[model samples]
Target: MQTKSFAALAIVALGQFIAGASANSGYAGSCTNIQIYPPDGNTNYWKIAADCKNNAGQTNLNTKINIDSCFSNSNGALVAQLNGSFHSSCTNIILTGTVLSASCRNTGGANVNTSIDTNNVIGNADGALYCFNQGNL
Candidate 1:
């Protein structure tokens, strides 16, 4: 009976460990100590955090993603309207939990693709609507 009780306690301990690990499911690792002037918002300032980088080997990686279509919904969720001219030069636009990656044809019709940080999207999203309509962002 003592052995069975010990085994149950061990199982409970393991369960608590797993629960603690999963509580930070969206933990971001790419966040660095570097600081910037603007648009440097976290995934709600904590928890998930990372950097947003433009495509590889591009002279002007600052290619602006016209996020004019993004807006806050009534439900306090982010609505990024992607379509039409937004992806006109790109294909293979894939959104992962970490990044919004894509592949696209360059000016010479060659495929040039890169991924930016999805934190920009999430941070740019209705981040102001944090918790009961009160946000520190």
Candidate 2:
């Protein structure tokens, strides 16, 4: 009887352990909120994403950084001409330094505005001139 009780207890403990493990599963999606810097009268492009977790035995700093582009513009006006789309479920994205060549028309800049689920400005959002600043990375 004692042995049977021990076996039953072990099974219950194992079930709880598995459930806890499953509850901690992290999210998955393309990284977002990446900013890059470029020299004057020049263009630069790059792609960045991250997969991080806050626990031991779990992989931390799974960031992938790569140079995705370069451009030729000086007045900083050409810096906001980049065209790309990335989706993610993670929070805490950082865009440090200056951004590179990126530009977006009213409709083209929709990705940036929609990424945060806001209708701030994208040409006709409240009749404001939408500015897509991709250089302030």
Name the best candidate (by lDDT). 1
TM-score of 2: 0.24
lDDT, each prediction: 0.35, 0.29
Q: What tens-digit string does per-residue lDDT give for candidate 1 at 56-126?
A: 42122111222212222212222333222334454455555545455655556666556654343332111
Residue pairs with clashing backbones, model 1: none
| Top-scoring candidate (TM-score) | 1
RMSD of 1: 17.6
User: lDDT of model 1 at residue 87?
Assistant: 46
Instruction: Tell me the RMSD of model 2 versus the true structure.
Output: 19.0
RMSD values for the candidates in order, in angstroms, are: 17.6, 19.0
